[model samples]
Target: MEFLQPTSWTDALAAKAASPEAVPICGGTDLMVELNFDARRPAALLDLTKVADLAQWDIDDGSVRLGAGVSYARIITELSARLPGLAMAARTVGSPQIRNRGTVGGNLGTASPAGDAHPPLLAAAATVEAASVRGTRLIGIDEFFTGVKRNALAADELIAAVRIPLPVGPEQFSKIGTRNAMVIAVAAFAVALQPARKLVRTGIGSAAPTPRRAPAAEQFLAGALAEHDLWESRAELPGPLLDRFGDLVTAAAAPIDDVRGTAAYRLHALGVMARRTLAWAWRQYQSASPEGS
Candidate 1:
């Protein structure tokens, strides 16, 4: 296979426009495995590691423009304060070596239902920045995933960056895996509480065809909080409310029986994760300063 390395963003865009079939590889954490297994053989591999622009991140307005090539390790060390939910998920992605090499962009490109990054991104309402010689367009995270191992990216497009709003409150993520490290999740969940907006958002992974938001659960919890002025009170969440939220989260999943787990187990695990993460996030919210210090 041919390997193309471009050092600049413009050069990379031009190369991609010229060879749309050239699979882009930044971290290569996933692509390398597919290549080694001979599961995928493309005519060309576009090496993006040299493109410095894809590894830099900056906050713009109220959101962060997270470069597509930024490593999970960097997210943990550099961006945790701004993106706690994503950082939490990044911590659970593979081993230390993998965390140093794997990227959120690679996870997006792979579009796996089990991808650890997807849940937090979905929960945070992130956006994907897709670019080409034509131009760049922002894709809503909710609409980015198309199917199992599929995404909405065009053939000639490359992910430039992801934009996620700065957290207005607490966030949490968790997953059930066979082992603590280097194992795919049987089920994963993330929750983000936006008290300023009086909203609660949830993301479920490894329990659906695509990483997805628990809209029913979100709406249910948000409405409950609003009804009780819980957003302002910062009172303890009732057990029944948490249980109902978990049930709604379970209802939102559409999983299938796979070698990793049964559909029933995934649903059960999702409910548990949803309750636990929401509780964890709410506790953090409760303990925070009045001004969110």
Candidate 2:
């Protein structure tokens, strides 16, 4: 019913503390949908779009910090070169208009199990920065999402930014949907290689109640690569490893039969996307490697 746009963090926090129940709106991409359907209505809204400091972005000590108000359009255009997985996910989020208006904070705030950004952020092992009148706190992505459409944010808190540590190797992301674009993902995957440590982390979305790492698949791949000396050898990934990895990923998903997709279809698509993203990351890793020792 009432809107309060704050130009500074202090002002924002003051407004939030004043109205504890007031919804903090940044992009309004997800909240607008709920508002349109009359599913959510707050007595007041603390609009952070005009908060200048909340739109800042910077990279330090190999980690990138994106302001909560940063749009997908800026991410795709400005950060694509260094953070391809994030940019890829950002590109698939919604239409150009939506991307221009949507903020990463909104995506995290919504905390949908199938949100496009979650898998990539999970694979990147990102951290979220939240602030209130009291102080700031950094929470890991793994601990952020509590359940379906649920989060750990306090009523007086506002997401300040998202921080992602740089990967030591190539990363790739892919999603499966009924259509090419502008559709919700049935299954999404993000894979990253940490060659320095001979480690690989994979994140899967839409298949589980929350985006999570495919630990079994990751351990399996690590063992397979080591067995073939692929960790140090230039040998290509074995076909069996690929197949087994896909199967393991598929098994890890806890999908349900929903109107958007059948459980069986989601399971099938999880494997497909995993294989494709892994293969893509492997190729990029190989290409980035030096000519020879």
Q: What are the TM-scores, per candidate, against the unseen true structure?
A: 0.99, 0.96
For model 1, the run of ten residues with the poorest summed lDDT: 284-293
| Least well predicted 10-residue stretch by lDDT in candidate 2 | 284-293
Q: Residue 109 error for model 2, in Å?
A: 0.5
Q: Please, what are the lDDT tens digits per residue for candidate 2 over residues 195-261?
A: 7777888888898898888889999988788778886765788788889999999988999999899
- Candidate 1 Cα lDDT to native: 0.95
Model 1 residue 172 CA deviation in Å? 0.4
Off by over 4 Å in 2: 291-293
Top-TM-score structure, candidate number: 1
Candidate 1, after superposition: displacement of residue 109 in Å?
0.6
- CA lDDT of each candidate? 0.95, 0.87
Evaluate model 1: give its TM-score.
0.99
